[model samples]
Target: MRLLTQLVWVFTVLAILLAVVLLFTYDVIKVEWISFMEIQPSHRQMEDPLPVPARSIPIEGPVSIPGMLPPENPVEADEASIARGSELFEIHCRMCHGQTAEGNGPIAPFLANKPANLTSPIVQSKSDGSIFLTITNGVEGKMPPLNENLLVHDRWDLVNFIRTLTIED
Candidate 1:
């Protein structure tokens, strides 16, 4: 009878030790008991976010409607607007477009596709509305969209600043 009890105790102790080893090896075990967060839905880093609900305007207002022609540049290219655009370009574009808007920004060489030269006639000839759309939608696989980064007015300012790149540098 004593041997039977001792055998039972040994098996119970071994089972408990085995569980401890398993807990560490399978780290996710008993996570629900540890914290509710482990079981909740969570986003991973760099995860694509949920798409915006259809027909929803941004809090600032509609930038452009779907299936519409590229919207016109509503913001006039005044001195202040151009100045603001210059600042925005430096902050947002200088890394790739360069100080002279000549596609020689610090990171330009590192990119697989060279950044476009804003001073070039190709870019200069594009309509202000077209430039605005490029800034909004971005070049596929080349530039990332800035629509989320800049407000409508800010983008227009950036377009105006691009126009000024034509002067002799």
Candidate 2:
């Protein structure tokens, strides 16, 4: 009983000494550190008003996306093109878009923004051109620019793959 009492007293004294040291030993104490909530270029600041490089012929010839076709010629979606697009989608898009194109892939939870549910009717309503543009340029918070990672043909293929996600009522 006496030994236990002595041990308790020793611990109490040590804790008190430590608390006093921490209180006085520091030359300066800051309650909070300076921080920045947002530290990136805004959308307006990043926008480019200048004209981009002129277009060249695509490898497979004129392709059509729903909203982006030239007024004179509208190309139809071919089976071969869609098949190619599916291949590219599996290779580059499956990891984030899911193997079924459901937008519930393994990496979805960790992303700063959720991937779009491509199967939605609203997305399906968009023209192929709009889909192609989104694939090429990406949505501000949802997708990333895949142009560098994928060739122009591959991007077209991805557009077709997105088309396949639309369920016909």
Candidate 3:
């Protein structure tokens, strides 16, 4: 009996020590036995981007310089264009601008700055290019820049949709 008790105690101590060593190895030591998933760069890495030559035209065509007369509205406000614009507006703009474009969207109250009323004269009076720029660059502290989320054509479509809002008022 005495020998059995001593064997049991020894085995228990050994098991606990093994467990402690494993925990330390995993949590504190962080031994990387197999580094199959290390943070090395792959072939798709963009470490050094090529610089564009001075006065090079943009690949997407000429971008209007801000403060110049708003670039001409290339996208016509035809029925098809308006329909596409309306769809894009609902997906991106409605969350903040509201269904009626009155700056009363469900999330509008939660925002730090209220969205501008799209149908208001101040907004409607601006040239289409100005509206397009606003959508592209966004108002500081008030709106977010949609240029990343929206394509240039989509922004133009949004401008066309905004025009319909003024017509309705």
Number of the top candidate by TM-score? 1
Clash counts for the predictions, in order:
0, 9, 0
lDDT of 1 by residue, 55-93 (tens): 788786787777887778888889999999999999999
Q: In candidate 3, how many Å is residue 159 off?
A: 0.6
TM-score of each: 0.70, 0.54, 0.66
lDDT for 145 in candidate 2 is 65
Better of 2 and 3 by lDDT: 3
> Residue by residue across 30-98, what tens digits does model 3's lDDT show?
666767666554444555435557787656776587467879899889998899999998999999999
Which candidate's lDDT is highest? 1
Sort every candidate by lDDT, greatest first: 1, 3, 2
Candidate 1 has which clashing residue pairs, if any? Answer: none
Candidate 3 minimal-lDDT segment of 10 residues: 41-50
lDDT of 2 at 6: 100
Candidate 2: where is the Cα deviation over 4 Å?
A: 1-76, 166-169
Candidate 1 similarity to native, TM-score: 0.70
What lDDT does the true structure give each of the candidates?
0.88, 0.70, 0.85
TM-score of 2: 0.54
The reply for model 3, stretches above 4 Å from the true place, is: 1-58, 167-169
Candidate 2: lDDT of 29? 44
